[model samples]
Target chain A: MNVPLPNADHLVGIVFLIMIGLTITGGVIACNANRLVRAVAGLVVCFVGVAGLYYFLNSPFIAMMQMLIYVGAVAVTISFAIMFAAPEESKKHGPPGTLAGPFGLITAGLLFGGFTLLALKTDWQVHAKINDGSVETMGKLLLTEYAMVFELISIVLLTAIIGALIIARRGRSS
Target chain B: MEILSLYNNLNTFLIIGALLFSMGVYGLVTRRTLIGMLIAAELILAGASINFMAFNRFTAPDPQVGQIFTLFIMAIAAAEAAIGLSIVVAIYRNYKSIDAEDLVELKG
Candidate 1:
């Protein structure tokens, strides 16, 4: 029996490269853009690309969840924040005393170079699989092994929702 | 050595994760607005997720565990975003602007 290899065709390879490009470009735009709204837009693009990477990682369920939660919900929330709380234009380019563009670039470059070296030099070991990482397996584990954490997360989400409403609703009689 | 075939390697994903993380660091430090910093923080979270997923695909014995961890990270990020945005709104309501520099009453 022959198992088919993923991304063996050249077309998938090209698409992977394109997704990488999109991720990098979107990250640059999100971080470096002058306007806040544009930065949010960039973030949406970046999250979409990250979802694509999840697909490539052989986790389609996670990929769809990534797109739904991050790109769809989180990005929309940030854009809404931008619309409601648009920052002032005065001295928007740089803060008062902290380091600016070049220093940031240098620092990020050093970090990137260091991490790349580490990744390339280290030999990652593979282990035997317990399951095929299918959606069914994930669901079963979510209810069996990780049920407590799942319930706790729901509670946390509820608390966050209430806390947000209370904090934002205060001091309204100005 | 072949760039096109990089999709098949664990190191490739690790390198990309590292890049995303460094970009987040850069954005966090250089951004002057609250929203920009939040966006950078999201990038950092994404980088961490990618790292976990990469390790899961290549090294971990149980792949579902990593996906579970990533799902939790997504949940935490969502809650953080909601609370952070609400705080930003409150700050804007009080100061009439969302610039980090303007909200410096507690400065030493």
Candidate 2:
């Protein structure tokens, strides 16, 4: 039995709007928060909303990876660094440069306006899809056509791990 | 209504990407700490990734390429975060503070 849901499309649209709201709200919190921990929390929220955006973009695998790599690993690592560095509350409460806030806002506003105009004015062309962009296709391409870059990424990750350990471990014995 | 179908629109994604990118720029400019700058940098990268994914979904001839590119972006972001945080730790240990203004030792 096919029951027609009249408002389903509208509901989905509302959900998308909510996701956008979540993303922007989190970004504002992350950028504007005075406390580092609160900023990190905002980062987490923003990433979650980005993951939802990825879902809307029709790539569930990338969305899951966004959650796993960004929210899980990156955000947690940042919080760990926050704990290690311990940015003091008293120190952070000092005044910022007089022109920094307004200057940054103006810069960002100009950038946003320019990009929005570009996106709106340009006639984006749609092309025919060769593959469905599924996990299977992604895996095959990763191992075949893009194998070199894949291997290189792994090497880079290894180097980063070793380098990070060495750098963070320095001056410990003194 | 047409607004109800905004998810299918390419401009929507592009606008969102632009918004995020600008926010990142604002954050990077205004933030006073190295780690905060790093976070803003991550936001910038995320905005770029979203644009790639949007183009992949709407316009690309081969969808796999964009997804692959985004995956590589994620890997690089992870590595960057690891390296950047470690550096933050090292800087804190040496200077005993992570404030960007305090590290102006070369202001000769």
Candidate 3:
């Protein structure tokens, strides 16, 4: 088998490795960090790395949206919630019971191992190309094929906004 | 194997996504505070999006479907976050603490 490796391919591989590192490291920090603010920072880092991976997946638009919506909007909103709702410092530590330590680790490790094995063992089939999956094509499909779902999502967004407002407003009268 | 071409491969993305998912699960199980659990949930959603994108890149005939699905996930996550944070705020107002253990009381 004569397979030519382009110079760009190597660069992409390195970047991919770096992104994976970023994602995993940030995930660790997000999960393990003691401080809430640090956890938020880790979340931001992980989201950024995920965005990079999306770019590699050939959807730069989604990559940008991932960064914008997740890292920008979601992370920022979470940080704001932390600032407002959380105390100045998290001193009230929960009793880390006997099982919390080893059990959590074992569970997460088993899950990760299982998924990794599944991904490696499965021989996924590639289907014929229907479209290039560009932003233009996505727009067309959204309007034509997925119009109902698209509209429903918008309705969901509206309801979420209203519900959030109502929920937040409830305590003022009490 | 060259470093850059790693993105071209499917297994790398799958492994990374799984790792993220595991971390999220660990956090969800271990975190004491609601906000921390929310962060973990976000990580889990991120993992799902990665899997969708990877499948789109490698196996899907219409790649745009995965992209659109990811976008929908993002929108849902945003909405969820908004509502969840609001609920957190309300809970904090009632209990004066955001810790999960503190807000265990139920009213009749």
Best by lDDT: 2
lDDT of each: 0.86, 0.88, 0.86
At residue B4, candidate 3 shows an lDDT of 58
Model 1 lDDT, residue A82, Cα: 84
The full ranking of all candidates by DockQ, starting with the best, is: 2, 1, 3
Q: Which stretches of candidate 2 lie over 4 Å from their true place?
A: A1-6, A89-95, A128-131, A170-174, B106-108
DockQ of 1: 0.72
| DockQ for all candidate structures vs. native | 0.72, 0.75, 0.71
Output the better candidate (2/3) by lDDT.
Answer: 2
RMSD of each: 4.2, 3.0, 3.5
DockQ pick, better of 2 and 3: 2
Evaluated on the second chain alone, the candidates' TM-scores are: 0.93, 0.94, 0.93
Clash pairs, candidate 3, are A9-B5, A10-B4, A11-B4, A12-B4, A13-B3, A13-B4, A13-B5, A13-B6, A14-B3, A14-B4
* Predicted candidate 2, C-alpha RMSD: 3.0
Ten residues in a row with the worst lDDT in model 3 chain A?
A126-135
| Alpha-carbon runs more than 4 Å astray in model 3 | A1-7, A93-95, A127-133, A170-174, B2-4, B106-108
Cα-based lDDT at residue B54, candidate 1: 85
**Native contact share for candidate 3:** 0.82
Per-residue CA lDDT of model 1 for A1-174, tens digit only, reads 574455556667878888888788889898888888888888888888888888888888898999999988899999888888884542476543556767878898999999999998987786655336599988998999999999999999999899889878866586
TM-score of candidate 1 to 2 decimals: 0.90
Best by DockQ: 2
lDDT of 1 by residue, B8-87 (tens): 78898898899999999999888877888899999989988999988888788777888999999999999999999999
Q: Model 2's CAPRI class? A: medium
